[model samples]
Target: MESKMVIRQSIGFPRLVKWPRRVGYAAALWSLIFGALGLYWVLGGDGFPFGENDPRGQMMGSYLANLSVHVGGTMIALTGFLGIFAALAMVRKWNQKRLYFLLLFYAWVMCAILLFIIPDSRILQNVAYLFMFYFDLIDWIVIHQVFCMIGGVLWGTTALAYYRISRDACGNCGRAGEGASIISASKWGKVFTYCAVLTALPYGIVRFAWAIGIPLGTENIAIIGDFSGEAILGGLCFGGAILTLALIQKWGEVFPRWCLFIAGKRIPIWLVVIPATSVSVIIFLTGLKVSPQVVMMIINGEITMKNWGEMVPTLSWLPWGLSLGIATIAYYLRRRSRCKHCGKF
Candidate 1:
């Protein structure tokens, strides 16, 4: 029922767009423009075009640098402008839910095909490179295509839901109760804790190896240098994820009494919601960025693509869906409590 309600609210916005939606639209548009520019630069060969070093390589690279970067940037900018316009539409009470959902679905389809077909299938990879400029396009798809689709839709939808919640008869008073004991009331708390630990495992192993001067074989990651852009982006995401989890552990719906510092303090939703939402948004958008290079070992020719297919369901869709759902529910509960306390409704 709540999901249905959200769908209705989302669809209803176009009739009267709001400033908040407008701002989100602006942000989305900015991302789209930046993405387009990046894509264009990639095609023009002005920027770094890896794996292509010959004269033909240089020539192709050069052309893309000139044309795609400029053209792509313009296209991207147009998207950003459109987002701003959409936000205005939202404020004006024009529903944009259908558009947002369609955007997200489109993005998802793109990511799924890219992840499933290209990396594991030699035929697909070769074919894609013929016209797609796979290397740079891959990154562009991850960043702009995916990011805007999810962020625009989710934030737009969430903000609208928040507006509705503000107007409805809420169930809980805004008592950010002593969170010390709140965490133990349900199985969900344990699930969150377990998930957090699982998520941190890879980071822990890598960091530990690094601190001890052990070559963790993190070479493939290319966390430094010309191709370091991916690493930088991933690092930011990983860091944001860590920060979000910490907030959840400390200030979530229920903080255990054994916690320190803000033991009982109600964690600000921005602390948890913003970062959690961000990760969900990014992960969904980027399809987990599981490139051919990243998973080459596991996705080798010996491995049937069908077998590898299972990985996508787990890595790309499931985890983010679970986390997003949980974090959203938490935010809603908190928001409802706050609204009730303030007697806004």
Candidate 2:
């Protein structure tokens, strides 16, 4: 009740955001398409996408390669099946209450699983890369991640919209507080926002120093890959932290004076929502390596928890993911005018 009350008290105005119906439709359409392809592959007699006596298998090693080929395939097929209902739930007019609720529930559950439980198991495969190879389009691990990325965006955003429309209509309400900040999140949202910003800076600074040939941790530069790549990716992460401010600041709603093309114009909500929502998934995927992975290794006696050097830095993934996700949801709610159930300001 306090949570509900907080939402009601937070919004004292009658402004509304223009929900991106077109994006929702596109996601829905793709969900069905991707889901069908997945179902076909799963049911088909063909072997999994990777694995077997393939040259590509050599890149990721035996354990991780086989895992992706087998376990990842199963996950892909399951995600594809859910994608069908997820697409259908995007409809505001869908009459079947149970199905509608179920779809929303499934999307949220899958997102959590993707974000927390079975995080993109690409770390072992990535052990080969000196720098992050996540954006590499050709890698099989990257390919599987790409599917998860797309599905997460569609599932996460569609569920966000559903809850925005009808409070009781869907069990998955996207974020912590309902009737939350569609423009800017609540107090918790701000906390997470700052947390993300602060955590991102360390990586950016470290990478920048490394890029400039300033030896901080290593004496030999030969060990590092294109320092420029680290600098660039790190910069992107750092820059993303700045973008999170848009959730709390007016500049997010209006153009910063820098872009003369559309200065002071209201930035399209989709522009922020789409990227922010998608990044949240990646944040979790990356964070998983630190938290659960380390714990599992310790549990299995692969490593000792006492020598926790990378642990602290790695834990940043959780806050980054949480803050980004919360802030985006808050931004959506803050800007949107109508409530799902009340249908009133």
Candidate 3:
């Protein structure tokens, strides 16, 4: 009877790592290695990290003395360096959940901000220019995206792990509210959801066009057919938009009977939050990375309406990224404040 009671009250979250401290040590090593590379990028040859033969290296010459690359490199190096401490804290078994969360979140935000600020031509005009030349300059853009994307996955999954390890410390310390006093649905939440859906429309439409064989660029139709890979990502964006709608709907608060044994149970806060937040991080990193370059091209009169039409879906990424972040954060706060037991945060 006591065990049944405990099960009813417990959140049922699973442990991601059998040894958190060991994994933390591994993460620390990984972050340190990246930090070292970032250091090289700043202090290495001709201020471009790679040689003049690199695409990022080539782009450096267009600017006034590679100033932007230096600043971006320094910023990345700093974040990567600081990240080691966060991972190390976990290794030391720090009881401060907020401290760990803050450190990891800061790393994610700094990397995302730097990605948007750097203005790499590889993400020029809002679409990731992946297959342009294949190899020579590929590392420039590939590293930038891979770094940010990896950080997003790392920090997000780390957060979920923390929640499972220490639910109370990680913001699940909440209980039932007064009978007449309940948290109301937020209007801002609805607004952000609508915004995400709206912004996502352009991208979905473009992908649908491509899938149906509409050629938007100089790439041959069959060559474009090879771009079926992009269609999957676009589908994910649309899926995210649909899921965002749930944040503002009735289904988000309660489970339907479809959920087998857990039917009609109050939805687990972590379940919804972890996935939504993870997707938001990914979209923000991807979409915002192209914003500075897009704006610069427009300001310099290099992008006309005709050219913009070629990548119409990408234009929506900026707004979509921002709205997704806002919506996810709002959802998290609302859920955390209403955990079924222990009304403390």
Candidate 4:
């Protein structure tokens, strides 16, 4: 009887914990550590993670690469210090509407800079290379950028928690005194879902054509020197495009009958959300890095109307990422079961 009671208590513990508080504390702790690192750099520490201190920082085109140590370090340290206060305020559920909005703006802007602006295509390229059994491409810089992204995610989570808490909503699920269920939001979800799918087609189609030696957009067949890499990347794009459709499809919620095993079983929500969200961030970062260069090239007349196809597809990544993210959230909202923490569906 005692052992059974202990097991039951252990099982119930997770559901009873206040996740918002925990997430807020985690955000504060991350800010503290990051701030300490900045201070260390300001004090002449050996291995600063940004700008010229990073070996590949220039190649990655990190905006921080140009700043001197003192300037960058001070900025980082200040942001970290401010982040701590922001995180703590969210944790405490501070109810001042004006102050909360200010913090929300700050948090989201920081999140966008960290997650979208700061990172370049190198991170995604490195991951792709790794999957292709090319290990040398994975380096410390990539890991550092990943660390930055983690921090961004934490801040975003803190902002979200604060948003819900301020509105007196269930922190776990964001359900409040509402007129309709989250499933009702699926209408907009489908719109974004299809938008994401359409954006993927251009890149995928061009790559596929190049792989088949067609040179659909470029001038000459020689321009498409090698097709193997193009083929692999094109396949990946198509695969991603297909998987994205699952966001609005019935298969996303349950296993299909075609599967030999686990058919009809409910799919784990995080299983889909985590990968989708990560890919969306990566695509957005890649587009953010490339879009400026592409625009400059167009302005300089280096890339003209005749060759628009080559560069135009790259521009689609930003919107594609954003749409996919919204679609994923919509999928989650539509499929989420009753909240275990707040007892709200």
> Where does candidate 1 stray beyond 4 Å?
1-67, 94-193, 213-265, 279-287, 301-345
- The residue ranges of model 4 lying beyond 4 angstroms of the native Cα positions read 1-17, 53-61, 95-99, 179-183, 219-227, 305-310
**Candidate achieving the largest TM-score:** 4
Candidate 2 off by > 4 Å: 1-104, 111-137, 157-186, 218-221, 224-227, 294-312, 337-343
Ranking by TM-score: 4, 2, 3, 1
Clashing pairs in 4: 51-65
Clashes of 1: 45
**Prediction 4 global C-alpha lDDT:** 0.79
**lDDT of every model, 2 decimals:** 0.40, 0.59, 0.56, 0.79
**Tens-digit per-residue lDDT, 218-282, candidate 3:** 24455245456557645766776787887876678677788789877667556787777655654
Poorest lDDT segment (10 consecutive residues) of candidate 1:
116-125
Let me know the TM-score candidate 1 reaches against the reference structure: 0.44
lDDT accuracy of residue 122 in candidate 2: 52
